[model samples]
Target: MQQCYGSIIRRQQHLIRCLSTKMQSFSMSGLEVDAVSVLRSLAPALDPNKHKGQAGKIAVLGGCREYTGAPYFTAISALKIGADLSHVICTKDAAPVIKSYSPELIVHPLLEESYNVRDEDKQSISTRVLAEVDKWLERFDCLVIGPGLGRDPFLLDCVSEIMKHARRSNVPMVIDGDGLFLVTNCLELVSGYPLAVLTPNINEYKRLVQKVLNCDVNDQDGPQQLLSLANSIGGVTILRKGHSDYISDGKEVKSVSIYGSPRRCGGQGDILSGSVAVFLAWARQLASKGEHNTNPAMLGCIAGSALMRKAASVAFEDKKRSTLTTDIIECLGRSLEDICPVH
Candidate 1:
């Protein structure tokens, strides 16, 4: 009992310090955020009295037969970054492979691809998929809606239904990978939902701009263009990933130019998605407690961008040219510790 009380006290003290630290952090026209400080403030304290799922419960809604590594990277990275529980809901063909990657994840083989289902079965199968996801829909703090998610029409349709359910449940989502592909074509999936965050790389961002604003990518007025996209989508946050990460939730924009590695690896974006989901969950908790007034989605993006970049930088420093996505994942814990040490 004494230990438990001590842990609570320590947790409260940590948050107090985090709050004080945030007040001192600097920004310029809100164009840049103090990402390191925001990360520290958003990350909850390590408390012994906290039980399982108290830290966070994250779900990754992706993984397919052709691409298992991306989901594995996303789920495991969430676990490594301090989420208490991480789950993957994927097609049956990909579930075993993702499960084999790590026993830490609770893998659900619930989704169906077009190839496996008949036209008559698709309607029934999609209903089953949504039902299965709904069983645990409200349990997750956030859903990462794409990491190995392929562009199968049937699969994407089911995912679209799942998104509607999650939004109805008020569950936050970090969308990336082919999930962007789905949202690009069907803007209504995330159109007016404030809890949705779209993390887009160059190509994805280009497509989104073209689809939404009816124009090409504007590097000259990138910040304003990003703001316009977010506003047009009804305040859903967008994290435009590049040499420098830019984030906006229609109301405001922020940038993180922290130095990351030059290793243009395929799976780094997966790490960002998972990291953003976890941090977004934490940020939401902080907001619910009235600890911070900033938008949790915006805060989550800033912190995730900073931490991912820092981890990539550390991994590159150690492995240089040989740095793989796994190497960057390995660095998440240490990089976060460097920013916000456990008390």
Candidate 2:
């Protein structure tokens, strides 16, 4: 009788343990958000009394001879999304073309590529480039680095210096395109900085995994790997761009799978970067005011990804197979109004 009673107690304890574990898992899943709530929490109410630059001041650090459209897409998207000001810092050869894309953008034709600068003058030219960027760096709410940034050695070097300066001033950075290339190579530029966000597409994510984690991309355990990667980089947030975007800031992983378009246009990522920059600035503003609980970078990524997907969907509905990046950009304001009206 005693033996049977003991056995029953043991089984009861084991069942309780199993139930507790299951309950913990349920709790964790509950903490995972719908993402739209995050967007709503971060988006500020538009007040007519608000002054210029209150919405945001965004800067794009890219554009070169081979790639002018990318920086233009990024800068203009920020404006279309209601940023008070948008600036683009690009190579002189690319400035006029990007400027012509929109007169609203402040295009700085100060950056120089390897082909344009003599080897002996590289150091002095780089210094001048950094000086020009430094003057306006502090005024920027967020900097979007590497949209359409060519892999020019001299230009990359200058960007590295600019990133260092941005970090020192505690300005948040949204790194994409060739900026990912620069960060992947150095790692020191953004490692451990919570304010830094890396938005990497399939190939870029793979390279980042290989470079930082020193292993191949594991799709099955992608969330875990991404969590590890973000932790490995010292809490810097990463938005792994894919059919479904996964975001991590070392502590938790969240996926934003809402409202993505079927179109795979080239400049959408650029749009995402710019959008992320604006939202991040707003999120940071909220954080500084002690209003929100989530990590600002994570919130920025969620809102930016959700907004971009909605815009893409709206654009695709209108243009179908002919939908281009510009068409999608043209729909940003309307999409935002549909979700959270600005009145």
Candidate 3:
């Protein structure tokens, strides 16, 4: 019995050593992704033969009465960055407000809040909402969830169903803002879904690490912890937003360190989620044609981060300390043009 216990202890120590070594390997500085090359490579050629929607069609599932600007920022950013069609599916109350923000967006007032729906109507309303979204689900190239989406119980339940449907259809999804809230609570929705990307800010990332890893955030080994977190969720890619965005999809880690403005604006993250959705859609398109070998999520993340930083810099150059999210959005087009010219 003594000998057996000793052997077991030895095996446990060996396992710990192996895990430590693996973590150390991942702790090394992340590889610097070539944002410009990836952008140019994944960018679809401007062809006259392509129809209006051929470039990309993105759907943003967010927006509530209290916060309409977030989804608006996300959806509009997609269009500004060259996506041909952008759609916003928000609550009935938020629909008009979001629509008022931009006529270019196709806004659908489909989601329902808890205050409006009685208990008995929950099932039927949820079903009807899903059915309505189903008609357009297959047409979208990507979905961005959780912009100004308030933390309404009934509404989140509906969004959860929508996420499941998106997964069933194998559609790519970028979860941010309130979307991260839903995903963290119901991790099963994205577990093992490589097509899903989670963009979490500092606070959001901390919560994610605590919930997923059963511990506090460990910045000392951020890349390794992020790797573990992504792998823990079945290889879903996570883009940890910060001074330098770190990206990991369980296979590798990359960072985008380009200098952005010091303004620390509020809607910047919404822009990133929207930008990522479009770039990811483009990356997936190129990959389908055998144009690139890396995962579309990584390319999308790197490109989106690079573009956001460049736009921020451009906006700051003009607005100085008074820069706003709208200012950054305005610069997205010019930054893309400078990065990849028509000629």
Clashing pairs in 2: none
| C-alpha lDDT values of all predictions | 0.93, 0.92, 0.93
Residues 144-201 of candidate 1 have per-residue lDDT tens digits of 9989999899999999999999999999999999999999999999999989999999
On lDDT, who's better, 2 or 3? 3
Would you estimate the TM-scores of all the predictions?
0.91, 0.91, 0.91
Residue 309 alpha-carbon offset, candidate 3, angstroms = 0.8
Point out the worst 10-residue segment of candidate 2 by lDDT: 24-33
lDDT per residue (tens digit) for residues 160-228 in model 2:
999999999999999999999999999999998999999999999999999999999998678899999
lDDT preference between candidates 1 and 3, better one: 1
Clashing pairs in 3: 146-179
Please provide, for model 3 over 203-304, each residue's C-alpha lDDT reduced to its tens digit, 9 standing for 90 to 100: 999999999999999888787899999999999999999877899998888888775888897999999999999999999998898988899998999999
